[model samples]
Target: MKRVLGIGLSLVLTLGLLSGCGGTKAPAGDSNAGGNAAAVFKIGATGPLTGGAAIYGNAAKQGAQIAVDEINAQGGIQFELKYEDDEHDAEKAVNAYNNLKDWGMQISLGSVTSTPAVATSAETFKDRIFALTPSASAPAVLEGKDNVYQMCFADPNQGSASAQYIVDKKLGTKIAIIYKNDDVYSKGIYNTFVSKAKELNLAIVSTTTFTEDSQTDFSVQLADAKKKGADLIFLPMYYTPASLIFQQAKSMSYSPKYFGVDGMDGILTLENFDVSLAEGVMLLTPFNADATDERTVNFVKKYKDLYKETPNQFAADGYDCVYAYKKALEAAGCTPDMSAADICEKLVKVFPTISFDGLTGEKMTWAATGEVSKSPKGMVIKKGAYVGMD
Candidate 1:
């Protein structure tokens, strides 16, 4: 778990040549579109800035800011990111959407949870602005919508992959899946894991779900799993609960082969939990470039130099996504008629061919379902560092 150091707001505003065509075109004769260009092209983000999910949101924002800064520095496209604090609440996410829409932002990357993301998507697509999430893994959020895309693989894949790994490792004949009942992200992954375990003929001794945003101890849950002879514990909840579980289990000497999906980001920050508990823990995530190629090595060094922290998958996705957009923009010829919607359309067509020479050495492409696809990479936490799973 990397320590999240708070950094002062380092928002940089840069100007780009805005173009135009019609209703969607640059507001007629606008300075950038005409002679005097404004100092920004706006993108919006809405995330939990002051709640349990703040770490995820802040990390994502930092990543996006880094991407925007790099883009602006290269004089490719200047992006102004209007960040709205959604407080990790769905209603607040809706509010953020309305506000950003009213402010005329065309793209955004945020809302850590699925419910808020789904709500925000409904509002955003109505306004024709696309929301590209870095960590929203719930498949339900993207059903029937063209404007919402998450750069990470869907939860189903992560769930199934984790289950398969557990089975292959022979870690357990019976397993317990601890999840948050109310979270779409958690429930989706949990259900998928259960299905996969069953397919592998593993006995699911117990499956339990707890309330979200609660602090009840996991002693009862852990005892139940123990009593059921469960040898593996699958937690599909986000960082906070997962950390709590790890801490409690360590206290009780209740070690099970821990398995999880990508939602476990930031678990490294749990001060009391032994980092060794993370050893052999299996979680599925997009290939981290640092785990793969030389290009990503350079990018990581550059990012750390700029932000004083190693970049996470969210930031890497944002960086790659911007490049994806740039390729599409150039493909569309940056005409006056190239509305954001047009760009998105071009993106859908071009995305399949756009390969990421990402930190994760795997070549990435979108499966027709809009979920990013690449060869599976296992992230095994070992000795305070995430080592690539073979």
Candidate 2:
């Protein structure tokens, strides 16, 4: 009986040691923790996952996931993505960035909006991590950050391109502007748009502004634009305020041709929004879901199948950002085991030398200044859908 008991005890100890040695996996972000760590790279992103701007954040997250899935399936490169919620607040964005840093994020898809992106980008600059923002168009996001880059047109580019598009297409004559004065994204676009419009000799009839605390109502601004005899109304703001402006204008019977920049792309997706209010609305954007190219058709079909809605410019931007990173990584011959600082240095040296064709644009190249070069397409809302105007 004593001999049998000793054997049982020895077996129990052996089993316990085996379980301790092989049963647990490493943390998701630690590349040196073993178990295929060298075969995959960890990427982190932060955006407004649960706020008024959730549309942009969720779209970007889903879009990037699709790209990561497709690339991993090819069995050549692998990526693991983790996204945190910033709720569109700059302070929360900094916190989110710190969380991602703790997770050992090697590459970053910075915040979806400009203000949060500005805050997170500064941290990335300090940490020696590379960041490529999808829709953060404010120039300040990349002003002094050499390791930061953009996948969407910057505000100044959008503003100047918008003015040129309006003039080239003869869309309207007298233009009135309604912009969010306190937001860097809106104000940056507004300043550039005004300068370009002045240079082009475009007639500016009236100008008005709104603050975040006062965005729910636009009675005075609409009334002034209507009274000024403006034929076109330019909205350099997000979809939320733009939607409100549209509803209020219709209620007052003050209808004018409406034009917006990329910030207006998600208006149609707004919950309880009346799509008819946006009919005949025009905007300048880089991606159009209606394109007949095989790549675009496949991407659109996959997106709609998974997301239950059409992808917007923000989604396209996110998808392009991942593919752009992939291209730059391959060109630099970067390995998953490299430190974030090493990866950052390699990417910074290689991004300007490679051209990437993505869902957003073809042959897109980045400048040393972190700006992307691509042509913008004119799109109009027709029958509750975006149609190419070119």
Candidate 3:
């Protein structure tokens, strides 16, 4: 796992926009508008600032801050982001949301991963306080909610996409799954993949699982998968466990194609792990920092210059979401002092009509079901770096 350095609080917020059309636009002259006197829109962002997922939370905060700074520099509507760390715990995330709301925040940008985002949304599901998650992909996050929105392809979609990628490449007809039965994300993707693979007439040779508290060793599961002659092994979990699994698989001389999802990102930076362990490992993500498109190239450069490290998918999501929110606010003619309910109502009406083109290098839009229209890219690790699949 990547070590998270302590960052000062005063350093984080440093503190933390305008356009108009009548139907979707509020008069800049409205006293409730942010452009007016002493009206600063407050966005409360929650994520894992500490604990196992802090790396993702830190990236989200940085990307949001970049968007905040850039928008503030434009000198239109004023904005400030009040961020709270949930430590990647669902209950803690809910507490953070309540605390931010008490602190006067009307909008939210994240609860970085699916578990926490789902938790936080439960509290805001019927209210005006809207949430836009950066990386959470589980379908339940916004199942029937009107005020909540997702910023990535949902887990089920990702699973089906992975299955399609396998068929397209003719990589295998037999697949094995090794996932965490206790994790919402891993289990959700596994269920979808199993159904999709079966529908595609592919063979599922082995299905294995481990609880979150289980021992690190996966010897039994690995032996079973190998004995079943699996052409691919799916690891639907985060990088920490994924790294240990890779090391053990290499030790046992298992050389099947390994597959994963966005959570497998940052595997190359795992402490003391051999990058070679990830060679030929394939995963799905929306953003590749090294992508050559103009938007991708510029975002990567800005991210590297700001943090001295390449941006990950979560970071790109955070950046794009901020811009998306700005567009939504402008289109809805929202002002800072308007009732949270009204702001969200207007946004809900405006969202389906707009397309956002940002760091993801595609025009993204939302469905009435609150799903973000996105396609996952099949990426492979080669020479210790992510590259588009050949």
Model 2 clashing-pair count: 0
Q: What tens-digit string does per-residue lDDT give for candidate 3 at 1-390?
A: 223333444444443212221112223323123332136667788898888778888888888777776776676765677679999899999889889888777778858888988888877775677778888888888887887888877889878888878888888767888999988888888889888888888788999998868739888888898999987998888888888888888889987899898888877766688999899999998888878888788778888898888888888888888889899999888987676667778888888888998886477989877889977788999998999974
Q: lDDT for every model?
A: 0.68, 0.91, 0.80
Stretch of 10 with least lDDT, candidate 3: 16-25
Q: Per-prediction TM-score, please? A: 0.83, 0.92, 0.88
| 202-239 per-residue lDDT for model 1 (tens digits) | 78888777886454678888888988888888888776
Better of 1 and 2 by lDDT: 2
Q: Which residue pairs collide in model 2, if any?
A: none
Best by TM-score: 2
Query: What are the per-residue Cα lDDT tens digits for candidate 2 across 101-123?
Result: 98879999999999999999999
**Candidate 2 local lDDT, residue 109:** 96
lDDT of 2: 0.91
Cα displacement (angstroms), candidate 1, residue 187, comes to: 0.2
Overall local distance difference test of candidate 1: 0.68
Tally clashes: model 1: 10
